[model samples]
Target: MKDGWSVFYITKNAWEEMLRDINNAQSSIYFEQYLFNDLEKGEIGKIFLEALINKAKEGVKVKLLIDSVGSTDFFFSSETVNLEEHGIDLRFHALSRKNILSNIFPNLYRDHRKVLVIDEKIGYIGGVVIGQKMEHWRDTQVRIENDFVPLLKNSFDAIWNSLEKTSARPHQYMNRHLNENAEGFLGNCPREKDKALRKEILSKISRSRKRVWITTPYFVPSRKMVRVIKKAARRNVDVR
Candidate 1:
């Protein structure tokens, strides 16, 4: 399944590619990441804030959603001021202390997705987070152009809609036309014991004919999944 996809290995100079894409975005840019950095202060963050601000100035609709806990400093400090000054709608996900009860119960459910959707057509998703640390950290990202963009957009809209009433937008693009043939949503929630997507991933790996190359910063797997991988390895399958 991954064969036809063009994989680009970005070691240190991958920022240029991301910047180039952001620079060329025409209509809108929707970014969601675990962290964001202000480039002016040399935080080793994804130094594309300037370009994002420039794009907004050029009449491009820009919306950035960053995790409040993961990007605590950038969210609370003045680092995000420039982005707001240029008409970019910036939001922090689930960083409020007022909701003490909810925070205590589901504090681990942070927005771990690193997604960038341009013009509601091209989508980027992967393990890459935006920051100076990302420059040195090994990571992987995929550029997708299939019918899955609407699903991604809907996921973002769900989060945006659940914000405080004052923080909610007018749902301008939420109901806009989407390309046909898009697949169903691939949702993930750690609290859910079923974990359908995770099961599907393990099932695919067990059925693969070629070598299995897993690359992830976090490697916490369930006991059933570990058994499946062990079984595959014992079957003389190439597992890595």
Candidate 2:
């Protein structure tokens, strides 16, 4: 955290590995997810719940946040009471509001993050979540140590701190420094004037001189992203 990012890890079998990290945590633990499925979801969910409860009982200062809309199983469910009984600091984000405006656009605003940080030393970020529905889904889960971790910690803190705000702000985001190092976190913030991340990616793509590789199970690129990719291809930039 005090230094810059020095290590990076991309893991496919993330849940098992991350569970080990959580089990070994001696200090603090931060667990936030978009889909923290019910403990009955499967063994994965049950073990993680047990691990967090154990850590909290040991006074490890465990904090858990989940999206009320995304993690419908955990929000206002009896399982929430179980976690709270163990002294876990559990909170929900993007709680559904009872109004005409909220009902129409409920899908537009929801926390879609899956992150796990153990003792502030290791962090796991990706699309993976706990649930039987996601058991067979492919995702990119990264485990990293030191350097860039502080950035993630800060981002988590920001969202955690502003849990009550009804704005569509994001969690961890990437800047130039982070992008230049290796991978970058992308997020959209309504509070920002220029929709910063999109602009930054456009600028980066336009200035590419070597190669560009884009991969997604879902292909729904915006018009501007399509333009940049096409422009890069015209320049023989090895765009994919």
lDDT of 2 by residue, 1-240 (tens): 234322222322677788888989999999889887757645667778998999899899988988887778678679888998999988887544677575655445666778787888888777678776666566677777866676677667766776745644443333332435655455555444557667877889999999988655677889989999999999999987
Q: Give the TM-score of candidate 1.
A: 0.79
Off by over 4 Å in 2: 1-12, 100-103, 165-186, 190-193
Off by over 4 Å in 1: 1-5, 38-46, 99-102, 146-151, 164-185
lDDT by residue for model 1 (135-232), tens: 76566766666666656777776666645466434222222223454444555656556665787688887797766777766899889878878877
RMSD for each of the candidates: 4.8, 4.3
- Candidate 2 — number of clashing residue pairs? 2
TM-score of each: 0.79, 0.82
lDDT by candidate, in order shown:
0.70, 0.73
Best by TM-score: 2
